[model samples]
Target: MKVSTLRMALLIMISIGGVNGCGGSGSSNTNDKSVSPTTPLAPETSQGITWEPGVFEGASNFAGRCATPRSGVDPFTGASYPDVEGSAFEEKMWMRSWTNNTYLWYDEVDDNNPADFTVASYFAQLKTNGVTPSGSAKDNFHFSQSTDEYNTLAQTGVTASYGFSWEFISSVPPRQLLVRYTEPNSPAALAGVPRGASLLRVNNVDFVNNNTQEGVDALNQALFPSQSGETAVFEFALIDGSTLNVTLTSQDIVVSPVQNVTVIDGAAGKTGYFQFNTFIRTAQSELIASFNTFIDENITELVIDLRYNGGGLLALASQLSYMVAGPNQTNNMAFETLQFNDKHPEVDPITGVEIQPTPFYQYEIDYAAGLLTNTLLPSVSLTKLYVITTGTTCSASEAVINALRGINLEVVQIGTPTCGKPYGFYPTDNCGTTYFSIQFQGVNEKGFGDYADGFIPSSSPSFEYEVPGCIVPDDFSHALGDVNEGMLFAALAHASTGACPATTLAGNAFERAAGQHKDGLSIKRPDALKSSIFLQNKILVPINAPK
Candidate 1:
């Protein structure tokens, strides 16, 4: 009954790809040459989601803008709208449970209408039904029905209640264990694991006959034994019929959510690459460190892959943008903007005064307080850039992409369309939840590509006909199920030949889902692939959307 169960379910449901990449384009240690190739590959077949003329055409715009609640109330203050809307309930709840930090309860008892059977009533009913709402609930019952209803009811604290917990079901065949790419330098990769590898077993635990959920449960238990200083030795069977043993030492390694420094094969002796991830707290410093490493390498045609990354901490995004654009370049446009409901204007925590909402981007931040410093990170003003994208790219991610593209930097998209999560959310804490919503839209200096459902890349990358085996890179062979790594390879080839006819785009249904244009766009309707692309191509979709 604890909301953390609901949070995990929600995270899984909305987790989408958290953004990361795999594979290594042989290192080149810098020339600044550009390669514009003419690929003769056939166009990818159009996926079902075509440029169908309709309103709320894409998933993100519909989800981020239309579907989500436009307003919320401050549970504590009762001040609605502009004053205080929804709290960051999900985030806070997640952290609380994750940290085992707090115990809170909510019920559907109505203050005015006592018989309404408020949250309190819902709890009573759960007790009657023999369910305990406790922190340990996460380990036993994964939130199920309350989850389904929460999706239906955007707000968390509502009187109406339904609950779902994981129930022991009949024995089922084990599913292929899958671990996605999270960081370019993930321990999996540090141990030479590649993306797309199926984790068949952990430490010799055969999942072929065990329940898939049990396998995952076992894996997590081993990987995260305690809150801190957890270490484990894991042996994995890859889909390619190979096995690897990796010892992961847990030392509170900061999950550098953002990865930096990428290399795309460039002309003769150059590499074209780009790097931009999200704005977790340590983003700026990590990016700076990555930039240093990249400059040290000899790369030629550089690409700034900022396709689907929704915006995150403004300062972080701006810092990276400055590094690329250079110190001399003007802060071309507002880094970000926010809007408040007319009813609940936000008050400055320091000044203790009602803050005025403004449309101008500059006015939103406290520039006078030096909070909006204009210092630049190191700038590598590469002219031509191949931006890898998909529909999921959004917010601060889009800002960096648009900012560079506006300067006429050759920004060639290679994946799918990008998600339009442009509006910046000013995180507001309520009760315990962290509330954020689409408040205002953003535009580049040229005033283009703002709040658009997605950005269609100019060119598309093709997949390889001879599938690459999905084995951990260290143990990878040509024997596993056919995988189409050629798509990314084609993008790399584009840096050299300016044409990689060897690879062709995925068929039509995905074309529409990702975006109209071919280059590095993500498949919006990726779920559609479960029945089609997987059936036809036999290729697993990339675990992560293009950066």
Candidate 2:
């Protein structure tokens, strides 16, 4: 599954937002002020509005008060604009109040004056500045994007692209980029840009060694075009020691989140394998179809490649988990239980309803219609699951590994540590911008969600965060799902025999150098090129909210 240019642009924007931490205001007492203001406040000038120190008004008081009020109905939601003419200060106020009320770590945030910063800057510092146990940022998921962009990608999984998802083995000087995979029928695929092809240049700019700011900017623009119909010349070193240059035209492409579905005949019987990229709404049908094939083939083992899957819909994760374990093992068990801040212990702060555990969904969901169909999801009924991971495997993807383990199902992991993110939020759109604040932490049925450092593949596992599996580095030498690929091969061997194959670094010299990075053998993407914050999260739609 390849990333769309729009998705890449959004990810770059998110990267910028992360660097400029979400700004905040003076510290104040926590309170439930979720109620909408009965009467909208009269429009105020930007200069007239000032922060009242530690005091905060209800978020609703400033909600829909846009600096630039949108007049027409939202094309994505089909709802009339609730936007009212206001200053950017009003938007900042909404962010401040909303963070305090629903943010999982509300008190940890330093409240700086909203007037001191722009709306985007203010929203950036609204999260905790503390670090996790591993010394990583405590809240790495905070971000905001235009509501239109968020809705389009989340709903339809569509993006403008040349359909080349580059795997950044290294992003520094002498950077190494490879075609991780290409979308079916995309320009890259049509150009025969196979996996393992090394990216040498983009439109005459050296992709690997161009260190100048102007050159890097040119590379970013060409590599991630903002709109469809844009064209760029790419030079690639193909697998068979041949160089090829192709001019790819970016087009609007629907992402096929599930790809390479196959039933592999192995010593352990037929093993079902598929690379699941994102958990978007459209993935529901694709997943069902794949699982139905597994059922039909009577595969005894399952290998899910989530090395590039950052995540998407939480409900989709639940459904996938149910299908893996089936009704007998997960019949009445909660796939995950969401825990909110103490202020809203018994209720969800955003939905204003009693907290409920997310169950194993057994039926198909019409996400577009917001209805559950009567179609029973096909089950593999497997006792064990094989997962291929990397630092990019995150959120809903991690939830699958954790939830299955909670039910005592064996999950043999391959590759390096996963991008630990047991946290999630409801993407709340106020005015024209959607704010994604960490609202809750999800625990499995066993009440374990503390893998903030990430779930590591280890030979000797001592904690829940560590799982028994081979510590294999990704192989760029072979295409994903190919039996010769390092990760999948390790999984298949482990399935056939009860032992992991001996670790051997595969791929070319650049790949080996990437594996030898100080951070280990995992693919290293620039913060800007990392998976989109939208994808690297467990997004929730309030049960009571409009579909």
Candidate 3:
């Protein structure tokens, strides 16, 4: 049902209740969007609800009804397929998911908008604009869909792309993307696409041909491919203003989370440095191997680079927390806690079974997910770990930081404020599009989980809606693990001194480049959709109830 229609329906109840025997002065249900046992109807207090009820057509794509179980259109691919929401079919599903599942539900959305809101129009309204993380009553973080991408990226630590992820440098027309990084042996890496390279053109099209939206549309079409083996020629400008053109075929690029691992022989000691990109199942083996090497090296301190990581699997996150804290330090403690919504019992809502507080996982979950494998996960059991971040660091990644603190470990957070997201959900797919609504917020053993606007540098005064911590900007000129790089250097210095480096304000590299940055910084918008993190890899509950 459209938000407008839903609002009208909400109002009708008041009058209808008085006319019929359903009289009640005000909504008795505290959870407004939820359907309580006594109040079958969800509540809404939007001004739009006061208008006469508009027809609940949904997005013209749903044929005026949800739960039709028909294929939806892929707006990106225009494919008549199952699971993806390119079609008009998703408006109803999207509305229903938030109405039924989100923590705030009816209190924070545009409920009175026309039932005719398109997918893009409605989605735009849902985004939290300038809203910091500390404001928990309303949710503005956008982008929710199928877990298909999440599952693949987490399970194998791979994705079907040209072996590289990118960031768009141009905000206006003729938008150009900068190659963020390439998977070591993937097609893009083989094609010699270097980090910080300017993607000037794609498949003969000028990325910013002329019109603003047109350029964006062109870049999206050429860069984002739905299937593997799709071929596209990329043109990049190298450091010397020289142009290099290379043709690449897309494939499932294995993203070993441990991008670069080494023992840094610094003034402090032999510190183990690990640059992690994503939290995938494939990370387990490499992580174990790396820690074993760390133990062999007798490393006293550790530095973890998570500047580019947007979270992945929570289980892997738990495993990593365990590895860093070890059994001796974190013995029998809650790695994190997952609390369900108010509508359900304080337990696993779907299984009707109970579960312990999310613990630090010590072993890899089986392929069938039936048994916990006997293979032991490795750990260093350090008292502290140095972590680097950018605004992109989020979700399960934040969980690692949170869980470690929960178990009495010191996590020296270096870099700028992290993307404050203590909430997570199992991606659910239905009617061709996947749905993800925030179901719970997590806390540490100290019962402190409210870091919504993000953890800022320690020097910044504690104010409303701010997370206090170290502050630093991303350093693009130096490679990640290099001790001289901005964030890493700050972390290394803090590892020994235990004092946070001064917060460095991020520069407008886009303006500096006008297309390319002289300092070799990659182009990224902190608020862009690409920067948002979706940490999956939990027990997903597929919600398909259509009424």
Candidate 4:
């Protein structure tokens, strides 16, 4: 289902007339649990994961960073806290960027409250637009959390994990937590956890008990342990209905954002296929390499797989867009313009740095090496693009689609609609928490960025995918790049013939059970389970909190 560009444009135009133009926008202690799950006596021998070729890997840097200097007094308790300047700075940063500070609940807030609530939570309490229909979905999803886990991922393009992402179909008693996909060679894979395997229990605790808080807490503890190398017992049932128990020790699993790069043969010459998992700095090297292959093959069409990508750096998005469109088309085109609140729409709300449009970056930036070197970008000089997406595709990922389309390039979006986050943030850290509020709205070249409800696919009839192709359902049964893979197959089929296939998007179980579970109780998704899609290179500028 591919929506025509004219129709999409009209939709955006209509939405812009009525939208609020972008505005701004808790915890309970549960029964104390052991810091580490009780160790099991005997563990089963590990088996090597049967990995499909081209699955990505992760890496990390041993070099440490000097912590940014910060400190602030608690707004509620008047207790001057030192070494916590980031939180206070983060609060002020939001005060400047929130699209609608006019409607905040600042005057109504009590100055004297619990000491537990710091500048981050206090500023969070001020988000009022979330109550309205078109407002922010103010939830823990709007928090600022800090973790070494994400740092390793963004910097080195790697992360520590059990090597699998779990999806809970339901969140209550009788709820089912299934293995979404096991990273090749991940602990979960080595322990025999496969895609569609039902996670039965963790450390003897049922995945879902009638008690919501306790069950979630236990699941979180097991799923997202604080440190690597910790071991836990996992009980799961495979798709074939065989239930088994395996013990897995957390390891520094490298999570490569780029999954697969290959050519899908088609009657229309050749189509370059790239399964991109995230827009990280580490991906540039691989992208360059893949494009070199495409150049040699003389492939003009492309299919980009971003089904599971939760989004990352905007800089990388700009870089990829440049590679796709090439320097000629990218030269002066504003890839993106950040729209802040009415208060300070023209200047940097947080950094006081000049608010400028981010042009298509011609070079790659690697933060770790602290160097900006120009590499020969494999420029396809594509006039059209095919982006494989899902509801999970968001933030900077969406930016890629929007930016490409903004420049008059034909962009055919396949799979489910994007996660609908044109909004992004410069991750602010306060008290070891990375906070991302809807700081700004991103508009493309034509000034069209009205995708708050997500990009709906036109089911009017279209091909599987060719790149420069159409929208379709996500198929998760096979490994990426395999002809059996749904999205890739669609792209290949569409490339072979610029027409729709007689395909049935029947029973998209993966979409049916991704983070949509609300088991009788209000289940707030933590950042770890589902991360916030973000733009990189944007960081919090040091600012003092209000007295």
Off by over 4 Å in 2: 1-48, 504-534, 543-547
> Against the true structure, what is each candidate's TM-score?
0.49, 0.88, 0.71, 0.72
lDDT of each: 0.34, 0.75, 0.55, 0.54
For model 3 the local lDDT of residue 273 reads 91
Q: What tens digits encode model 2's per-residue C-alpha lDDT throughout 1-547?
A: 1101000001111211111121122222122122212234444476566678678778888888888999988887688899888888788888998888899999987777666565666676788867767666777677777777777777777777889776665665677788888999999899989999998999999887877778877888888767799999999998889999999999987888899999999898999999988887788889999999999999999999988887777778878988998889988787788899999988877767677777777767667655555678988888999999877787888889999999899999988777778888888898778878888888988999999868988777999999988788878889898999989999999999888886533322112444433422222343333225444666776322122
**What are the per-model C-alpha RMSD values against the true structure?**
19.5, 7.8, 12.5, 14.0
lDDT of 3 by residue, 298-360 (tens): 999998887666666666777788888887887667766666666653655434545345566
- How does residue 202 of candidate 4 score in lDDT? 84
Quickly count the clashes in candidate 3: 17
List the candidate 3 regions with Cα displacement exceeding 4 Å: 1-98, 101-154, 173-176, 212-214, 240-242, 459-470, 499-547
Model 4 has how many clashing residue pairs? 19
Candidate 2 overall Cα lDDT vs. reference?
0.75
Per-residue error at 210 for model 3, in Å?
3.4
- Backbone clashes, each candidate: 69, 12, 17, 19
